[model samples]
Target chain A: MMESDINWNSIYEILTGPALWFTFIFFVGGLLIRLAFLFRLSRKKDRVIYNHFSLAWGLRSIFQWMIPWASASMRQQPVFSIVAFIFHLSLLAVPLFLSAHIVLWEEAFGVRLWSMPDGLSDGLTLIFIAAALFLIARRRIRPEVRILTSAWDYALLGITMLPFITGFLAYHQWGPYEVLLILHILFSQILLILIPTTKLGHMVLFFLTRAFIGFEMGGRRGARSW
Target chain B: MTSPTKKKFEFENNTDAPVDVDRVRAILNANDGARIRTWLSICSRCGLCAESCFVYVANDRDPRLSPAYKFSHTLGEMYRRKGKVDRAFLEKCYQIAWLQCTMCKRCSMYCPFGIDVATMIAVARSVCHSQGITPKQLAFFSDHCDKTGNHMGIPVEELVDTCEWMVEEVEDDYEGVTIPIDQPDAKYMYTVNPREPVYYPQDISYAAIIFAAAKESWTMPTFGWDCTNLPMFAGNRTLAGKQVKNVYDKAQELKAQHILITECGHAYRSMAFEGPYMAGYPDGKPPVKIKHYVQLLHEYLRDGRIQIDSDKKIKEPITYQDPCNVSRNGGLWEQARKIIPYIAEDFRDMAPNREHNHCCGGGGGIMPMGPDYKPYRMASGKLKADQIKATGAKFVITPCHNCFDQINDLSEEYDLGVKALSFKEIIVEAMIVPDHLKLECEK
Candidate 1:
């Protein structure tokens, strides 16, 4: 079909309907399966008992290390931490608060929420792009990180940044508006599909990994991992 | 300084050794649980864990020695290969998991993702052990423990003789004191690292002095007297389980209410924490209470069971080395800090004290790797040596025996002019025995 003759309604329906649900199912279901597998594996015959168990301590570690200046990792690598903090903050904020995302959520679940100003959303998207560039540059320049940088690591970074880039272009109508919108939806969908399977799984696994270490260090070892 | 008396075996250069890819794969497959999978998938290669590792830092930030790199290359590679690795690669895995890394868990403390890199390395060691590709010394020590119930292979007669010798020394210094051995119905059964009797017999004497001063009813069993478990470090889980089970059974047979592990970090961690788990006990809880001597010393001081003559203090500045096992892993940092000030007038804290302290490079059974690996091991302890040097302390007190040995080596190698002493030794030097318990000549 010609680009102008394409039926936009059907495409939007497919993108928001079966495709969205599929991504959600795969992301959530795959996560649950992985978590269950980890729990089962931990139940081996010979298990070391951690004498101390403090839910408060574990939770404290989670929040304590979440801040930019709260952890030694952040202090040791300030530039990376700043970029990473902004990247993660924008990654979460721009998606959840953008007017378009709020509209989608309202339509899907019949819930209305506050939306971020378009200017703020645009600025966050720009920061996200800049952070992604810095991370890529770091991977290329820093010898230690350079050695560990694999093809998949670069691909994950590219895949994650694509949606934001396309979404920004579409919002400003800088590129072909119709094509950019379609590409944004497609890229986001690809990310969702890859979330549980690839390094993108960090999005879900971060909490579990942090909690495990926190509980281990706080309750059992009587110290914080941070 | 001193070289290990045992001759080194040339395992790494022996390329003719057979490779058991199937057995390696089986072990890898068995260990491919959620923990390993999550860690492998989640690490973002941030390189933050490098600073936390003494080996990585001491090696001038070499990426190859970083905890992340070590795990990714060895365990991560094994997973990628599905354990169908060649003999040469397995040998490299042995070096990375066993020799290079001390499995100190300090990296876990600094990891943003909180990944337990040490556990991953231990899993790699387990795979190596299955393939008969372990360090010769570690394997020999494991075999010794399996055959003779102690790493040193001290016969019961020799063990009794050593105890009598220690008892005689203690009696010569102080009256009305005894080293009770094989005494049933004691409140606590005290255990020692085999090296104590073999190389540092004075450690036994120091412990005897403390027990006598406290007037505690404790026994040292002839069987299962050694608490150090080489199998734990070698990642021989079955053998580790057997070793722990032997100690537990001995404690049960003697009807001791508690098992007091000496100033050995890994021994305390293995017995009180890992042992019960290895022996199929739920939550790793032993049949009886497991206590470290540091904890006991702290308690004894608090309860007035033992008195430290704060007046009789060390003349020079002193600092404490937090054992990775006892402080970071066992949460006994505060106890040592609390007990040190009472004994030393010039107690100074290491800048990154407590859980963040560097490993002494003697952990993970690296000490038993012998002289062939000593230069490398001592080199990896550069950060620790620097930390000690910066403190400018004349004495470095560490509660763990492995730390004691490693710190002593670091002191001698770096020419820091410091003496390494265990907490028990410090206590004996500074403790005040009552006149009633003192011998007439000494009084």
Candidate 2:
């Protein structure tokens, strides 16, 4: 009924409709292309990996790294290891199983999946925010970390944290709730689009690398990469 | 600082060498395999690799010494610039690749993605090597390998002469001990680091004593006697390949069942694991079975081929320096550990020993890089010094010549008051000489 309300509604509609679809396609398709390219390149240039490939070693390498304190390096830097594991866990869980996110996915796909309890999701979101800030502070405070940190690293971190921050604020009605929701969707889409184009590609590339190294070190050399 | 009175081996930078952009691009393109491309693409620079790097920890935790920073700034920058990097940039790459990191792969275990930073450093070295931008000492050794089939440029005649020399010394203790040269159909065709023949002929005598005591059917190859491939450390892969092939072909020619490498770390890694791959064997296997000295030592003790005299076992506290190539890359850590307890009464394992052990900072051909690098080398070796000091062991035994030399220097510099030794040195002391092999004086 109000003019500003109508303006926000139209903007929200576009972001959720065609814009959201475009972001989803770009994210999934770009990642698939990257995976395909790396696979083809590996086949051509590094046949040694395929020759020595072992599913057992590869899976073991991945799982060992997945568990906290399973690696000596992880054990050496206890704080960083704990924070990193928690940060990654929250990054994956909150995005997929948060009730609001599930509702959106179900609405768009006409499909439904289990959603985590709202309280738990909220707690994870807060943890994600805190972990992200801690990581940024570490990058700033630690000399070894500080020298490697670039403006781009800080920018990427900001991009990753914005959606959660805005969502939290919007959920508790801290500011213009509709504006915050729209900004949240926008930031989430931006983050998705950037995944395949930036260092965030590690989300998937990590597994392939772990597997390759696992084969080279474990299967061939009888040495564990992890 | 190196004393001016001490002759410098010179870092051997060809400052006058022309930096051909085409050559740079070609080298980068050739090395830009899936591993490099993907690894360069995905490093988020989380800097967890800092603590994993001994150099970083040793150099007052300098971030520039971080393994991630080292490779990322060197090869990653080269790839980012599409190999259009200038001579100045390539010089920096040379410093980072050769001087900063040891290519030990300790950081590889720490990387969340399991990124092989050592591989990247190798590639970076290759790139620098293309432009005549390598440490002079390593380059000279690589050239020696190319010219004489050994790192020290020792001719086949000299290798035979040294074996004879070692035989004369060993024969006084073990009557029948002989350093057999180029014998055909031997069970194991043994090889030595060129350093043994040049600086430490006693090591050859020790090997002869062990073989005599064990009655091991081993023969040394006259032409391919040198197992260590400094070319690999020099980043000259072609030369490295040829060096490995010499030993591999010699073993094949002799009809030897196995090629037994000496108590050297890089020699085992280059000759066993990396050499076949460099020589175009994708499966990473040479035709003949390759065995490290550690593996053979373990086998001899386990099968009772050579018995360790209980009374002669080392009584003082001792520790084993796990060479990166021998333990981490070669996976003979358990074998080395098993050998230690058999030969020593008290064995104190270094904290973060085995696959996770820090490099002694003399690898990647740094020891061969000579006196100019001694200052930085000793500085980087501080972590290893501290590790040795913590064990409070009087004897620091290593299966690697590079590690032995570096640990010796660390002891001298850090005042650790430890005697650096090799596996052969300990075994020769503890091994019981057989009745038949014992000299008449002892009998």
Candidate 3:
């Protein structure tokens, strides 16, 4: 038992130290490089977009979409819209403000943002897990979504959900707690690496694309795209 | 409304011509720019775009017909394969790009990422175009536009003769009405779809009468009078640019303040919006200002250039079919809405009107795709038919010829007993002529 505990501790330390830092650098640096490359390419080949880039229109388009049910499209598919909002909000919030994650941030960088209370964090994590399951079920059962889904899409969903699952299990002290804690850290790092590299890159690319469409539809033509 | 007889196109399939794989690669490489690259990279396949597509809904929500699948299986596959795709693959891509989707851009609005699947479909069509695999009817019109300045191959003599003929028809209603041609320093250099001269010359007479009532100076360019760019719909960017440049040059030569486009949606979009980009203008704008007919009519009503007879206004329930290009892409939605109250007493809007309205299923040159696609076109138009039916409107006013024809066809096919009228038709029917411009017999 002592030896097993020591092994888990070393693994946890490694995941929380160099692995976490490496993942952070890769996530930020890689996305920045990719974004810069794409932005430059856009200016070079599609300079028409730049000639009519209106900040007011772009922000209006983005802002309208950010609000729940602000768009006709959102209203058309209310169930999916609500679930997506919840999923994305929880996805961003849990990682940034969960009390446990805040502890890591304070220890590593001597900085911390406001943290969610333990009860609220627990509630949000359950909602996140439910939303993830709903998304998976949607892909599995919804014919339109299923047809668009490939093995890679399902795998990405699994990768995204595993860290949260493992973390929840660890917090509840269910099963091998140390192993679950180490897996939660490792799975999260893996997700960070995959985000800037795979379809998960949409997390950042969505803003650019939304802004481009806004500029094209609204700025150039004076139509509200959202 | 008479349908133009389907012409037998020479290069319908062009199967004998060897598939130009190298040309396909070149075109794909050129079109795979930053916008397309980012769009392809970011599509999460959420399938939220599925429900927004009228075609998918009309076809009973088939997953295969979903916009996400349409773009992904075509352009996404080509990009994944690095444009080394074969003729059979190109044939499949052509089916999905041309037959399955209308590139109406409705899907883009629903996308959380704002993925312009229509743009991807257009790029897919362009790739197919390189391999000589375009819809034959569209290809025929495109070739005509490339060779002659008009899609129907109407020569300058025919257009001038049509203008003269339309002037005679209009003079019966308004004594001094004339369809002016190449009148220099005209405030508006007007343009029309080639179909106006070919099948619906009455459209010309209505415009002439409207201008006479408004006391506005407008002239049609005899050289580049055809404003519609069917070549752009065929994915022939070179021909599209050339066609737009023809109109632009004519407007510039005439020194017109605004190049007023007739009541055509795609023509307005091509001339005002996409054409300049395709023509590679530095500012991405036409040399002269481009105006749609809706905007002009709205201005005419607002400025009291023409008076509407309140008693002559149609009292039947009316609904408007918002052309995707004109309303959504061209930013003229409110202009049409403003015009409605002037001409109709009872106007009922469709459930999802304005920019969110479904395509009448004839956009992107689908109306010209000919008899081969009629059954599918009618089927896909089911969503629009239902939208119109729900409003229970007797008259459907759409300013676009494409929508006019499709809605008329839908009315007939669905037995909805509705009349599809262009705004020009409605306005001409209801507007009162000034006594000074009235004919002797009428006065």
Candidate 4:
């Protein structure tokens, strides 16, 4: 590893520097906007569903499920779900456990973490890109799904594949890798901003919904608190 | 796409025709008014409801039976073509209407958006009502409720006579129990589901015994004492309203304290929630405070009026199946929960209990919807059966009559070996009638 031996041409770096600004501006600003709206909901349904038996245990279970430590929902449909599950698992693992991403976290956020080998990271990243594209194609190709799908669904799926596609290309310094890399970071940042806003809100909202059902149904029925 | 064969199920009344379309739509519009517009607009079609529906679970993941598909035939078409769809499309809607569902709201519990598929199907039924393609069974029952003041065609004489009979039975257990029907100044004119009078007369007996044991001030009206509504279940709102007004007028005539709907899902729903809406009364938060049987009984149990025998408890493990109309439709869970454990000793739970519990596979008039979906009914029952099997419970304590019917049919056909009993049956089995108990409230 020879430091400062290789360099991007001045103009290319200049082009990418503007992209960095785009990433940072949207990433920070969009996150704030997401949080502001989410917190602003006037109705306090949280109290209704908040299990009082053990608040800490409930929160721990919720956090574990959201992080999805050993979740079994995907087991409901094993064959179809495994590939997607593996892809999701690896996508999460690679983002949290990649040497490059890990190093970046330490640089920017002052966090330290272990990372996987280069081959493992590369393989997982490839799986994520391939699996995402497969899902999109399957969605378009399936008639029943196509009938129910909306414009936002297609756009969302396409946006999801962007970070993976650009990230894969950005690796190995292939065609347009540097440019694609900036786009990858851009899309990833956009996804972070979207997590609580879009249907991706399913991540935060499902537990709330489940807990609501459990609590209301239980209380109304005079069962012990959930 | 095609009309269902009427030969599958024998319908009792055929003279009356289905309502005309404009009138049907007008009735639905009057009831829902415009809420249908927003609810239909927000469907994201996540398909979690498919997992929840009995038909879908029973049919091995067939996309056609999914509630989303069923709705697409009617509400879906209305939305997609901006209501400009052809008669062929409307005809397809009718087939999905009569064949696919019984209007049970089990799917709504799983819906992330809380879209009431049962209500939408009722809209389709109202559309069918307009087309004059109403099912013979529903039209008959609705008409029966209209003309006879009860869906079973129980005449005023027979209704009073049944109550008189109940009064006599209660005299055996309690000292001065008097079960009066149509008496002029009674505080309550209790209305029972037609099921109790027609197929399960003993259910009425249990209610009477319990009512007497509590020494409560309640009476049954000779008219409006039958609470079952075919039109509500069949999805005809005009007929549903007419069906409801029969009870409302009779209850009003008696100037009763509260009309306690019998242990039937649709009856309680129609009376407690939809009845007020259609009869020019308030919505679910009604002024009249029409109580469910569970509410009445639970209150009686709570106040030390009606008590069950803890020693008389069924030795077998018993679990409850919550009917959506009772638990979710009206949000009356406390009453049932408080009362259920008192009736049985070995209380167990079926997985996904309460509002999340699966449908009885016979609500929304699926029992009368026809025999065309009987296989689907049994198949869907497997999910519930599996849930019960997990609990290792021998009996399922379902409060609603149709739940008893559907679960009984499935248990018999599928060898579930699980007895389906009404809360009354279990309660009566364990009831300890006080020797000095009197019918008249001391108040």
Q: Lowest summed lDDT over 10 consecutive residues: which window, candidate 1 chain B?
A: B1-10
Docking class of 3: medium
Candidate 3 scores a C-alpha RMSD against the true structure in Å of 2.9
Best by DockQ: 2
Winner on TM-score (2 vs 4): 2
Model with the higher DockQ, candidate 2 or 4: 2
lDDT of 2: 0.87
Write candidate 3's Cα lDDT for A36-129 as tens digits.
Answer: 9888888777776688888888788788788898887798888888998999999999989999889889998899789999889889889999
lDDT for B362 (candidate 2): 94
For A131-222, candidate 2 gives per-residue lDDT tens digits of 99999999999988899889999999999999999998988899989989999999999999999989899888889888878777888777
Q: DockQ of candidates 1 onward, in order? A: 0.62, 0.74, 0.71, 0.08
Candidate 4 lDDT by residue in tens digits, A150-186: 7887787677767777777788777766567767777
**lDDT tens string, model 2, B66-162?**
8888987998898888888887788778778887888999888888888999988998898888888888888888888889999899987777888
Name the runs in model 3 displaced over 4 angstroms.
A1-6, B1-11, B16-18, B441-443
lDDT (0-100) at residue A154 of candidate 2? 98
- Classify candidate 1 by CAPRI docking class: medium
Give, for candidate 1 chain A, the lowest lDDT window spanning 10 residues.
Answer: A44-53
Candidate 3 local lDDT, B1-443, one digit each (tens) = 01122443223575756677678778778877778888888788899899899989998888999998999999999989887888778877877887678888988888888888988898888888877788888888988988888899999988899889988776655788888889999999999998999999999998988888888999989877888988888988889999999999999999999898999989998998888988778788789899899999999999998889999999999999999989888888899999999999999999787878889989888898887678778889999999999999999999898999999999999998899888888888888878878778878
TM of each candidate vs. truth:
0.95, 0.96, 0.96, 0.70
Off by over 4 Å in 4: A1-131, A134-156, A159-226, B1-45, B85-88, B169-174, B183-187, B280-284, B332-337, B370-373, B388-394, B437-443
Give the interface-residue alpha carbon RMSD of model 4: 7.7
TM-score of structure candidate 4: 0.70
